[model samples]
Target: MTVFISPLIPVVIAVAALVIAVIKDYRIGTLIVVILAFTNVGGQQIFEAYHVFLLIIMLTAFSLTLAVLRGSVAVQGIKEFNILLAIFGTWSFLSGVIAIDHELWFGMIEYMIRAFLVLYLVYNSFSKGEEIFRLFKIIVFSMFLSSIISFFAMIGSLSLSVETLLSLFSTRFAGTIVDPNFYAMTIAGIIPLAFVLITEEKRIALKAFWIISVFFLMLTIVFSQSRTGIIAISIIFIYSLYNLMRKKRVEILFFIIPIIVILILIPPAFWFRMSVFVESLSSGARADTSVVHRLLLLRSALDVFLKNPIFGVGLGNFEAIAGRYTIDPMVCHNTYLEIASNLGLLGTVPFVLLLYRGFMLPKHSMQNPNVRELSWAVRTGLLGMYVAILFLSVPFKLDLWILLSIAAILGRKISSEKSP
Candidate 1:
């Protein structure tokens, strides 16, 4: 009865699970990678430094090795989009070589490479409709887990009350991502996937799970106090509402009930934060320092773009030279502006084309009846993400790349089904 187990036993079990994941299905390994990448667990200090990166490398290598053994490792799906990404990557590398800040450039390049690898792995590893659906479920589950973490974090940090909420206007619930805006946007982007799952799942228990997950996810956004996240989620909700009304009219309760609960739970402080945008528009006075700062950053980015219209000041050099144009000396808060100011037309053109290709994938896939719902989900999710990034300068965000790859994989599955 007093027999004890070694601590290494847990490690051994984990290794065994990982080996099974790699050998049984590369999709499982890829899903593990996605969960790690999205949760930002590997970046945390509790683990050894860069442990997440090592896990990613090992999982990716194992998955690719399995693909080779099964004769399934081939460059496939979204050829045109891949080409555009390649061109963009090449241009960024060339631009980075002459960057005003080599340190920043190196860091950016490293992130870019990792994001690209995730996209490549996901697109090639998944081909079947079931596989794609499973991927979507796993992604939504990961976000749901993140939302739970944020809920507890908020609870532990401060007592919940209207007065306390008002006093903590600056407090943002970031969950594990560490950045409130990005965390909020990430949750908003996954909401569509959750909605799709809700519509597809016939089991009451599972449907309820998704509904509760959505409620908590929305609550996290309100706590984040991110204006951009609010806008993005509003767009997604409107889209999902339209889709639900057209088809799943009865299931509308599943969507509406959670939203009502969130509306009730949302604090006055959130509305006050959101009101700044309205106040600025109505009065043409930038009372909010954050809004004013972002506008100044926007103007400076435009100025940089105009000054270096072809190749830009150089990749990741915008912040280094930002002080020359504006007092902020910060990277532009807008993703489009960040790219336009950093890479200019040479990089911007291919990058825009790549996004267009991603959109087109889901647009085209909607024609196939079997995959229509899934395609709609991907399109809506991508739309939310694209909108969210307008105010966030994150060109190398892992989630964006993963979503684009999902679109490509869905499109490829549709085409293969249509083939004779």
Candidate 2:
């Protein structure tokens, strides 16, 4: 006996939020984007009926448009990365047009367009330092909320009876995001942000809040049992440790002790699950089918790229074409390979350049102490995200775009300060 709330409830709430945001400031619209970025509308599918994200995006766009019309906005000039992204997007659409799988191409292109729009909106919504910090706080706080829910979900699943366990842990404690790997990667990206927040906070209570949030984030990622997520967090942790050792050696224990304590306190089940990674390391031994499966898909992606090295088989066509090579007929599972196979060398060049520019800006902008600390976190967190996505084919994820947008904003701010 499942009960349903009228879809109108969410609709009304979204409408009211949008209206208030419009009446307020474009910054409110920015806040809305940050809020929705950390939530999803589908799983068992109840929330899909409410179309929460779709409504939020549409309303945010409308609010921004209204604000612009009222002379409250000044459009910023596009940056180098924006140009590369636009070129990449055009190539994606052209490839989709010529794709052998018309239906899939159409659906994928439509979704990609919406994703770009979200990126554009979020990028344009903030032009000041305060707005960016506000957005960052919302993003970090949303991550904290997500981590708490996922921690509880994992605990609840652990307590379930054997007969009921299948239904619960199937999602592996994913809260709003459906896939455990996606959820874990999301939290891992936040780990660096949490570090930055903790370091910058002056109030003891606020510092404590970020400290607890970091704990939950670590616990959630470990509980997720995602190898990619764990690997990503390891990279971030090592980078943070290196920075602390260079600048604040005594403070290194603050991070190290908490992680050591968490590991000691975690249940034995966590160790058993983590052992899959160790087992898979032995050559010629397939401890997990997914490892071998990814290799097969990677090989197929290489074949496809070799066959169509110019423009690719076409965007969104890898699964359609690569299925012939793999037993399960799945995605390439590697973001770089997926781009190579789907968009080919032509599109791949600009796509790679986009990442290069996005990352380089933050690396160069570190001369500004304020921007350096924040930008470093975004840079390293995004690097971890890029590494994590190497094992998953989510090129159009909102967080990736949000991160790139943040980098671009930082670049713009830094450049503006340097100008006469």
Candidate 3:
């Protein structure tokens, strides 16, 4: 019962308190708003998995429209996202309108709706910056608790009543989300937040606590052995260490570690992931057992592109189209190939712009120490996600979609305050 409720209860009470506070006092609403956004992330994503977030998105549109019409451009970050979503949505409809493949059209609309909701949270959440920070603190606090429970559960250190409920492999150790890879990636993503917070943390004990959390998070990351999780963590660590040791020599050390990782650690795993891949490239079609399967899927997608050329096959039609070329019904694990094959250059280009811009904007984000400091956690995690994508065909996941939307909204929020 303790493990069952450990993850859920505090946030629930925080939400109730937040709503009550918002009704009773406007100042409290600030924190409430942030609390709401922070708590909502995994929940909404999980809800969406069950197809509920779609209904919620429609309701949100109505609610948000009321807010917008009242001249409450109060959430400029959300506003920019709406703008981008509009572009994305408009193009989505264009795909439906022009798409020869019908399934792709339906998929595009579904993708757009979810994108909008994610944008909404990001946009509005920033309006409560201090609250976001507070909620972040709360989240880190909660994560710490989760870690503590998980740690003892590991070594037979405690024979707690909830011990049976805790299984590190499937359930117990998840930071917030239950999936180990997602947990690692998300934790890695937020390291910048901790890094930023540590700079402001005055209490010696609190500072030590946050530092310890980093160690715990890294341990789990390595434990997960999800290639992307490790890669993402490494990327964030480099960024964090660079910030910590500002001297040129320290920066070089950051770069040097990766060389050692590649030389020492990555070879075995990389070779394992690439064994069939290297063989396939060398001898042509003989080796089909490895990550080369994904590469094969890419070639099939390219063939579909060549055939359709203009609009290509259609969203989700890669299965259908690829089957026409190969007996096996395979999906393109490569996003670029999938996008071009399905929607062709037209449907895929603008969305690519959205990603390109989001990825590019972080460099500019580094300009201000405050924004950098504040956003670095998310940014660091993003850097990891970026590096991870080279190995996994994961960018198309709504996980990334949600992440990218939040980031864009935050960047817009920060930029808006700077402009005026």
Tell me, by TM-score, which candidate is best.
Answer: 1
**Could you give candidate 3's per-residue lDDT for residues 1-420 as a string of tens digits?**
454557778989986675554444333443333333333342334755336434434444454555557776454444333454565466556666545558755765566565555555445545433544554576565555565566565645445556443433332244435555555555565555655455557789987777666556555554454555666666666676776677444434433543354345333543453454666768754575544566677888888787777675656567666666556666675666767777676556666776666665555555655455445555665676666655444334444554565466446545423310
Clashing pairs in 3: 78-123, 104-315, 189-381, 192-376, 192-377, 193-377, 232-384
- The window of 10 residues in a row where model 3 has the poorest summed lDDT is 30-39
Between 1 and 3, whose lDDT is larger? 1
Q: Decide which is better by lDDT, 1 or 2.
A: 1
Candidate lDDT values, in order:
0.78, 0.73, 0.55
lDDT of 1 by residue, 1-420 (tens): 699989999999998887776766676777777887676665433457346565665676677876777886665646767678877899889997669998888877877787788887888778766677777788888878876876666666776788675555557877778788888778877887887788787789998888777777877787788888889988887887898798857867776886788788777877876687777646746467777777778889999899889998777889999888677688798888898899999888988787778877887778776677788888888889889988998887878888899888877656535311
TM-score between model 3 and native: 0.67
Question: Which residue pairs show collisions in model 2?
Answer: none
C-alpha-based local distance difference test score of model 1: 0.78
Ranking by lDDT: 1, 2, 3
Model 2 misplaced stretches (Cα beyond 4 Å): 1-14, 41-51, 153-171, 265-282, 414-420
* Top lDDT hit: 1
